[model samples]
Target: MTRSVRRTRRILQVTGVSAAALLALSACSSSDSDSSASASASGKLSGDVTVFAAASLKESFTTLGKEFEKQHPGTKVTFSFGGSDSLAASITGGAPADVFASASPKTMKIVTDAKDNATEPATFVRNQLEIATLPGNPDKVASLKDLTNSDLKVVLCDRTVPCGAAAQKALDASKLKLTPVSYEEDVKSALNKVVLKEADAAVVYKTDVKAAGEKVEGVEFPESADAVNDYPITLLKESKNPETAKAFMALVQSAEGQKVLNESGFLNP
Candidate 1:
């Protein structure tokens, strides 16, 4: 073969190789860009968000969870709703969670004190005590003093829970003490005692009574003014998705969030 012809053939071969390399590089860049765009557009917040809330907030918070899921689309919210103290204990014990919403500042302090919180918690709501009785309030219990009636059976929250602690404070403020047949672990349990007709009355949060919705009659006692509980919310330090957690909390503080809480009878904190 002629030298010029051989040189032309070599040039063609090099040109083909260069074209192939450029095409491969372009394809890889396009694929990477497409993947990143998909991830961002969907915000594909893919992970579990664990929430620890007070028992009294169970119903309302569950509703809020549904709304949150509807808004986030792909995120999952797992809730551990129970006594505020119990929830706090779990969070402090290294349980995995993204958020902590407590019924009492004291319980929230437990998490903050242990340095389990990622940020300063904000008080989102407040609740006051109420006298919850059977649907008809058959005992005709009217005032805090009425609870002293020997014929009336009353249930109270255990001292460890927020509602119980508030009950004690209300009683102390009234300078009245009466023995309760049962000390429940949480407000719902105390409310249950009344719901089941096992007790004549129970000292529970006003929100709880409202949540009960005619299952029990809520009577506002003057003494309850002295014992108010502040609800606090915070993001956890060990959260796997801090950004999404923060966003969820922001939603809770938003107007929509406040609306849900207020509808549940929680006072703005």
Candidate 2:
């Protein structure tokens, strides 16, 4: 071959190899850019997630909220804990909340029926009723039947509340009737009545008694099994921060969240 032809061929070969290298580099750069964009979109989470939860879940949910905030920096978890039915009413009435965790399915229905929930609620735990008595059992309250004594200053949650409804169910299940001295709006208030020594005993959740620590003594009865309440949680339809809300819900249903709840005396759903 001629020297000029050989030199031209050599240049053409180098040019082709360089073109191939450039194409490969460009493809890699494009792939990396797409991946980085995806990671940025899905991995970055930040905002305030307001949770409306039942009064009975205050302890466990608070711990989970703190854990959620810790896991995602630049995020805040604020909770409104109250009666489940009341909270449901607030949600349906256009309350700005990211999540709702109710103490019972019946109360959860209030929100679901109103189409205020973004997704169907899932039961996360179950709670049983327990008698909260004065420290050291001054009244010697032992069983559900013992609360029937007319002399006893017994406080109960209002029938509209989950705890109150559960208590009534247990009372009915045992075929016994007892009038309460007073009815409170929520489980916490009912339990507080006993803690403050205003009532000799209160029919509240086992979790409430556990949360009360040494302030009150918990008495469990067989009838509680018949009226165990199921706790359900869901995302609200009007949440402005849906992503953060969902992440918090995922944390609640995660193993780590369940551990906190189980430690707080909640039964697995």
Candidate 3:
């Protein structure tokens, strides 16, 4: 072959190789783009986030869960609502949970002490003890001192729960000793006793009384100021969905969260 012909052939060979390389690069780029698009379009955050909260928070949390679902379209929020101390025990026993919101810092300490806490908990709300009485206040049980009256049938939360602890503090502060006929496991049950007229009065959370609405009347007492309880919330260290848990925490700490809590009669922390 002539030298010019040979040079032209070499040039053609180089052009063909360049075209092949360009085609390979384009194919790789397209594959990556498609993968990313598929991942983005799936619209599913697949994981279970178990939340343990105090029983008094049942109604408020049910509302908040719906709101959270609205905010995070595909996320699932599973709640285990009960007495804070009982929930604490469940968490300590290796029950899986992503978050915990306790009515008292003391109960939260149980998880924190076990090193199962994800981070430092924040006080989202505060609650004080209140006297939940019959609809018409028939007994006229007006004050903490009055609870000591032998004629009154008073009930209180179990000593292990926050409400019970606060009730004790209030009674101690007033230097009044009263014998409650029963010590319910949680605030709601104690309040229920009054609602059902099983007891004449019960020392429960302000929020619980508000939740009960017209079923029972809440009478504020001066002694309640001495037993204000602080509620703390934290994410669990063993969470399978940390990102979603963090997002939920942000919502609880947000202005919107505060509005819901306040509307439900919880005091600002």
| Predicted structure 1: clash tally | 0
Number of clashes in model 3? 0
What is the alpha-carbon lDDT of model 3 when measured against the actual structure? Answer: 0.89
TM-score for every candidate vs. truth? 0.92, 0.86, 0.87
Task: Candidate 2: give its CA RMSD in angstroms.
Answer: 5.8
Q: Candidate 2 residues 75-157, lDDT tens each?
A: 99999999998999999988999999999999999998885465899998999999999999988888989999988999999
Which 10 residues in a row give candidate 3 its minimum summed lDDT? 40-49
Candidate order by TM-score, decreasing, is 1, 3, 2
User: Model-by-model lDDT, in order?
Assistant: 0.88, 0.93, 0.89
Which 10-residue window of candidate 2 scores lowest in summed lDDT?
110-119
Cα error, residue 190 of model 2, in Å, equals 0.3
The clash numbers for all candidates, in the given order, read: 0, 0, 0
- TM-score of candidate 2 versus the correct structure, residues matched by position: 0.86
Q: What are the per-residue Cα lDDT tens digits for candidate 1 across 1-269?
A: 99999999999999999999999999999999999998889765656688888998888788878788888877878888889988888888888889999888898889998953657899988999999999988888898888878888999999999999999999999999878999998899999998888999999999999999889999999999899999999988888988778777887888898899899999988
Which prediction has the highest TM-score against the true structure? 1
Model 3 per-residue lDDT at 58: 85
